[model samples]
Target chain A: MQRTTMDLWVGLFVVMGVIALMILSLKVGNLNVYNPSQSYVISGNFENIGGLKVRAPVKSAGVVVGRVTDIQFSTQTYDAVVTMSMDSRFLFPKDTFASILTSGLLGEQYIGLAAGGDEAMLKDGDKIMKTNSAMVLEELIGRFLFNKASEDDSL
Target chain B: MLLPRRLVSGIQHIGHRVIEGVWRLGVASRFFILVLLKSGTSLRRFNLVIRELYFTGVLSLIIIVVSGLFVGMVLGLQGYETLQKYGSESAVGTLVALSLVRELGPVVAALLFASRAGSAITAEIGLMKATEQLAAMGMMAVDPIARVVAPRFWSGVISMPFLAAIFSVMGVFGGYLVTVVFIGVDEGSYWSQMQSAVDFRFDIMNGFIKSCYFGVAVTAIAVFEGYDAPPTAEGVSGATTRTVVTSSLVILGLDFILTAFMFRGVS
Candidate 1:
């Protein structure tokens, strides 16, 4: 009976540990919180995605409503095309803005969605027409240097 | 400042000692392999293994939980302060979760386990040897390595992951209590943002695998030290001290190697 009691507590401890791990992975890590309804797909084009990865959060006003599903290079346009799977519950207008945003100065990149006042809502396979690429700090600095050098040359 | 003859001999002796230590390590590896084989082959010591597991694992749970909670609380408070400056205070969840899951959880848990349980295992065995209990068992036609050492080693290995898991859970709860209830960070963002940021396979499972390897290495060192210690009271105490120190250094070194290898493609 004592051995059985020990085994029961051990089993309970193991269960609790497993439960905690699931919470960490699912609730905390956001591994698989499935939406029962089917999701809608859309695509966007950006000149520079910076460090965006597939499975990155797609959020609206800091609330996550979707995930980046795929990233591809469009051969004709030489632009990075990003596909996303948005939850069925959250619907956006046709002219919603998709911007690649970093959480902090040196943090992971995610997509930020800002709603537009369009009469028509976006449908499945719709394109998010206006997309802003990630801001590149080095490129901005280089441009500033180049402009400064040109101004000096003109003088 | 030293005499030339003595200094020359000292340099030569150091060189000789390094080579001898390397050779001894190789022999220990072979002996470890034999011990591993014996552990798997033996069935008579199964009950002993269970008893050791209770002592090593069940007994060690208190220390793991308390430390894990404190560490989580500290991470939450500090992470919140840093991230709030950038107006990305919501990312505190991601910071705490990732740090615990990837690095701190396994490493800290292992360190605590080594100091608490590993040293204890070494002392217990060393005391048995000092008291000549091992010799008495040997006269009874029992293999001391199989009967005593292997069970304790195996128990230590088995206990580590469970203990680490418990520590991580307690840590997350501690983080939650601080961030959500005490600090007034948005609860939804705390959880959702963290989930979105942390990868289950790369972060969490890799930590678990790291803990498992740490378990094996620490227990092996503890058992080996106890078995090789001088059979005296001073010897047992010395061996216990060596167990904690050696296991800590080894754990830190292994954590670096594992992190380098596991996260190679990531950055």
Candidate 2:
């Protein structure tokens, strides 16, 4: 009886542990967000990909469909190259537009996709020809000031 | 001349202490390997490990749960206050979950385990040694390490990650209770935002790995201190104190090194 009681307690302990791990993975962490079972990679080139980072969400109409996998600079063209892993379930047309967008006034950045009415769909390893760069806060402010100065001159 | 002589002796004393520390570390490493080698017996018997698990893991559950909930609640309260200033109180769930999984869960749980269970293991073994129980087993041609120490060591190694996981889960729930129920944070964003922020492979797996290492380190230190304690009452007491102190310092140092490697700009 003593031995049986000990075994029962140990069994209970192990069960609790398994349950805790399940809770951590499912409820607390994003274990179910990006299923990698069927995903394809496509690269995009931008003139100035400001403040964009790898693993940033790739969203379509506010729904996340992929993740930014890699970011590199192309020395030859002086443009930033971003490789994205897109879910196979959501295919984009060849002329899809990829733009870097910030969530809030000062929050994380993500890639937004807008599909064009192209007959051809983008395949794995295909390059996204049309790309929009992230908006640099400093550059935006500088341009605003310059426009204000130009308006004053015109006045 | 006198001051110069004193300085020279002080330097010598420091050097001596360093060498002694290195030598003790070597001894501990050897003991750790021996315990590992003898662990087959514990695995084969199985019941031995279960008993130790009850003592070390089950007994520590109440404290781990209570502390985890309080820690999570505290994180929620403080995180809300800070994020509320920026009108981003919804991010409190993200903060609580990330901190608990990435650092506090494994680190704090290990610290508590080291104090509660680690000290008990050391005290038990030290008393057995003081009473010559180990020696009595040796007279019967039994390997005391394989019979006595290996079970405790394996039990600790197996139990640590579970305790840490439970702690982190409880902490997240505590945060939810405070932020969602009491503080009136939006329920949907509180969970959805956290889920988006925390990655299972990166945050959860890394935290699990950290707890496993802590378990090995804490248990190894506990058993080593107990086995090496001079067979006397004062000696046993001193060894118990040393086990807690050394385990704590090692846990913190290992945490820094692990964090530097694991979390360096991953986000």
The TM-score leader among the candidates is 2
List the lowest-lDDT window of 10 residues for candidate 1 chain B. Answer: B40-49
* Overall lDDT per candidate, in order of appearance: 0.85, 0.94
| Candidate 2 per-residue C-alpha lDDT over B37-109 given as tens digits, one digit per residue, 9 for 90 to 100 | 9889989988899999999999999999999999999999999999999898998999999999999999999
Residue lDDT tens for model 1, B120-229: 88998898899999999999998788888888888888888878877887787788889899999999988877777777767888988998998998999888888877
DockQ of each: 0.37, 0.84
Misplaced by over 4 Å in model 1 are A1-9, A34-46, A53-55, A58-107, A111-132, A137-155, B1-3, B41-45
TM-score of each: 0.78, 0.96
Clashes of 2: 0
